[model samples]
Target: MKMKGLFLAGLLWMAATGMQARGMEHFIDELASQQEVTRVSLGTAAMALGSMFTDTYGVKHIDVLCLEHCSDEVRTKFGQAIADLHDPDFEPLVSHSENGERTKIFVKIKDEMIREMVICHVDDEVAVVRLKGKIKPSDIEQVIQDHGSDR
Candidate 1:
């Protein structure tokens, strides 16, 4: 009888865990759908995607898709700094929007990088899919200029 109870508990736990995982996935999708993702770093494990939103505190705001935890201040500063270079919002970061079923923009930050993903552009359904490509802190504009439309 004890064994039966333990087995049932384990099954219930597993089911609960699975449900939680699915819920998180849904949340991710929902969160990604509503944002102006600027730069995304696919390589670095740090915060790779930065969502730009200037809160009342003048703090930079970013939502990275990497595997790391960043304080609100750090996110704010980075977002603000990045924004300053381009209309203080990085809207032009959506450069070279080649019409594809999907599209991505690579954002470079200082130490680590993050990716900003956009999904289903063809269908007018933009979603923060994931890190689009490698990111770092460098002259992204210069690199693009020098590299000639590769990055």
Candidate 2:
């Protein structure tokens, strides 16, 4: 009798977890349908195929979602789901608003290097991008060092 109860409880827990993931599936499906998208370290084709065969490790787990005419309801739901899914250890790297636009960056790091970063911006449109895998502060500094003079 006790074993049956425990099995039922475990099944219920698994169902709940699946439902939570389904909430985020809407956004994942939408972002995946975009034509001109990049997967950072991985080529676009590998990223697409990776989605089918295995986990994101081979592709570094990077994902970008750009929506042009997104509704407030969808955006709000996505934000809520993101909050639910994001790591508790993530720290705010940047938070700024100017005029009617806002940009926020949050990151999870260890040993002074970023393990994952989430970049979200809402202005003329909405874009939420997540970058995973090895990303150090030096990678960012290099971008500034290389292109700071261009702009």
Candidate 3:
């Protein structure tokens, strides 16, 4: 009888943990299921190749959802969803708007390293990109400096 109680507690704990982990991912997946959106996912190997020319050195996974030619309703929904997003693990890093386009970036950090990043961009089209990796703040600063020098 004691073993049965322990098993049920274990299962409940796992379920709660999984739900927390899937908080943001669940919304992204639902959005990607829309007929008008295009979803692209890259695993570790693909990310290594795809980011060869960029500053994604430590990135292990990437998921991108692009919604082009979508209706205004869909665009508004996407924006609202991002605005309403609240996750304990992810903290807002940067948010800005330029030329009628808005961009919001959120990051999840663990052990002094960024474990996940979510970038939500809304313009004429909507784009949501999620990057998972073990990245240092200095690494991101270097990328910014490198790009800033181009101007």
TM-score of each: 0.24, 0.54, 0.77
* Candidate 3 runs further than 4 Å off: 1-22, 49-55, 149-151
TM-score rank, highest first?
A: 3, 2, 1
The digit string of per-residue lDDT tens for model 2 on 12-95 reads 999877765654345456555555433334545667687687544323566777666566665655445444444346787887
Q: Candidate 3 clash total?
A: 0
Which pairs clash inside model 3?
Answer: none
lDDT of 1 at 138: 49
lDDT tens digits, residue span 1-107, model 1: 99999999999999877765653244345434434434343333332222232111111233444212344554444333322322111223353344443333433
Off by over 4 Å in 2: 1-59, 76-87, 149-151
- Give the per-residue lDDT digits (tens) of candidate 3, residues 96-148: 98998888999999999999999999878889999899989898898888777
Number of the candidate with higher TM-score, 1 or 3: 3
- Candidate 3 lDDT: 0.87
Name model 1 segments beyond 4 Å from true: 26-151
RMSD for each model, in Å, please?
Answer: 17.5, 7.8, 4.3
- What lDDT score is found at residue 97 in candidate 1? 44
